[model samples]
Each structure stands twice: as C-alpha cells, then as structure tokens.
Target: MRIIVYGTLRRKQGNSHWMTNGQWLGDHLIDGYELFSLGHYPGVVEGTGQVYCEVYRIDASTLGELDALRSKGGEYKRQLLQTPYGSAWLYVYQRSVAGRQRIESGDWLKRDAVSE
Candidate 1:
C-alpha cells in the first residue's frame, strides 16, 4: 500500500524518521483539500486548495507504525484520497482548525519559509 504525507513526515522534516524504510514515489498534489498550521506540524482538511504531498510505498507494518505516530483516529483520521500518482491514504485533521493559520500555498515548507 501507499500513503500520502503532506506535513512533518515528508522527506527531511521532523518525524520523517518513521518513514525511513518506505520507497519514495515522488511528489503529488491532492486536490480539494487545504493545509493548516498546527504549530509543529500541518494538517490537511477537506476544503479548497491543492495540498502538496509525497507518496511512499509501504508495507502493512510500516503503515501500522505511521498510524501509531499519527495518533490514528485521535488528532488525525486516515482517509483515501485520489492524487496524480494514485490512491493513497492521508491523515486528515480530526479537530477544528478555527484559530490556526491556513497554508494557502499547500506546501508546509513554503509556508514555513513565509513565516520565517
């Protein structure tokens, strides 16, 4: 299976260590969703805007590890989304983003750059 990571789990970001054994598929854009800042990490909520993501092919065990890292169904919920690469599971924010900053460019690192 494959998963789409849009936040801290992408490449060189913090917590990316969890994805060390997975195969990198490439960058992908998830449509009809938005990214928001939640301090250290970013969240993807169903809305309007392209969400930049990285695809990784992983096994059941790797997925399980990621689920644990993401808090599975608590702070984030897993959802299957269609991207240019294919269908992949994404961790969507389960809480309200009421006061958080929205990442208009859909790129977490780009948003971080603007903040800096």
Candidate 2:
C-alpha cells in the first residue's frame, strides 16, 4: 500500500531511527492538507495548504509493525485520507489544538530549520 508520511518522519534521516522503518519512495505535495506539531511528533490534518510528505510503498504485512510503532489507540491514530498522491493511510495525532496552521506544500520544515 502507498502511505503518505509527514512530521518527524519526513525529516532527513529521521524515520530511520525507528525499528519498523519504511522505505522512502519519494517526496510528494499533499494538497488541502496541513502540518502541525503534535506533542514532540509532527502530524497532518485536512486544510487548505500544500503539506510536504514522504511517500512509502510498504507491504500489507507490515501494518502490524507500523501500528505498534505509532502507539495504536494512543498518541496517534491511523486514518485514511485522500491525497493527490492517492488513497492511503497515515498516523496523525488524536488531539490537536484549534486553529493551528499547517506547513505549505513543498515547504517542509527540516530539523535544522526548526527553532528550539
């Protein structure tokens, strides 16, 4: 299945830190989606912006592993969203602050770009 990943996973060499690592297929621009900081991790939501994302083509067998890494029913939830790339599932923060704006398309905030 094709999955769209945003947040920390999108950062250079960041997603590799996880044991259940996914292959980086390529980068994509998700229209009507926005990026927001959810706790220490990053997530995306439905909005009017172009959210930069990393696309991953993974086997269905890895779903369990991915779910575990994402803390199933915890910090994040697996959601199905329709993006320009295609229909896919993503992990997003369950709780979010109201009125938060997401990153524009092709405008990913790299680790070095984030102010401490």
Candidate 3:
C-alpha cells in the first residue's frame, strides 16, 4: 500500500526509515488539505488548495510496525485521501479542538521552520 508522509518522516535524517526500504514514488500535492504538527508527527487535514508531500509504497506487512510506531490506537488514525498523484492513507490526529484555526495549504508551516 502507498502512504503519504509529511513532517519528520519527510526529512532524510529523521523518522524516514520507511523511505529507505520502501519504494519512493516521488512527491505530490493533495488538494483541499493542510499539514499540522501533533507533537512527534504531522497530521494532514481537509482544507483549501493543495498540500504537498512525499509518498512511499510499502508492503502491507509493514503496516503493523508503522501502526505501533505511530500509536495508531491513541492520538492518530489512518484515513484515506485522494491526491493529484493517486489515493493513499495518511495518519492524522483524532482529537478535536474547538476554535482551532485551520491554516491554508499554502501557509501550512513546517515544525522545523517553526523551531528555526
């Protein structure tokens, strides 16, 4: 299965282990979506315009390992998303925050940039 990854997973020296072993399918943009940081990883949400990120094709067996690393049962959940490249699953935060402003896709900031 293919997965769209953003944030730390996008960086070469970070949590990008999946990319080294998995098939790199190049980068693509997901329209009507935006990226947000949820502590350790990033969450992609439905928004306006296009959200850009890299994608990887991994074996289905690896899903279990990925789920554990992402704490799938807790804060994050995998959801199906349609991007310009194709369809894939992405991990996103499940908890809701009232009045939390959804940033535009073009203005979606990266965690590393914020720290810098």
RMSD of each: 2.0, 4.0, 3.7
lDDT of 3: 0.65
Model 2 residue 31 distance off true place after TM-score fit, in angstroms: 1.4
Which candidate gets the maximum lDDT versus the true structure?
Answer: 1
Better of 1 and 3 by lDDT: 1
What lDDT is obtained when candidate 1 is compared to the true structure? 0.89
lDDT string, candidate 3, 26-61, tens digits: 887767666665555556666565666778887877
Q: Candidate 3 clash total? A: 0
Candidate 1 structure, TM-score to reference = 0.92
lDDT of 2 at 61: 66
Residue-wise C-alpha lDDT for candidate 2, range 77-100, written one tens digit per residue: 788766555677777666664764
Off by over 4 Å in 3: 11-13, 97-116
**For model 3, the run of ten residues with the poorest summed lDDT:** 107-116
CA-lDDT, candidates in order: 0.89, 0.63, 0.65
Instruction: Give the worst 10-residue stretch by lDDT in candidate 1.
Output: 107-116
Tens digits of per-residue lDDT for model 1, 1-116: 89999988999999888789999999998889999999988999999899989999889999998889787559988998776667889999999999999998899989856653
Question: Which model is ahead, 2 or 3, in terms of lDDT?
Answer: 3
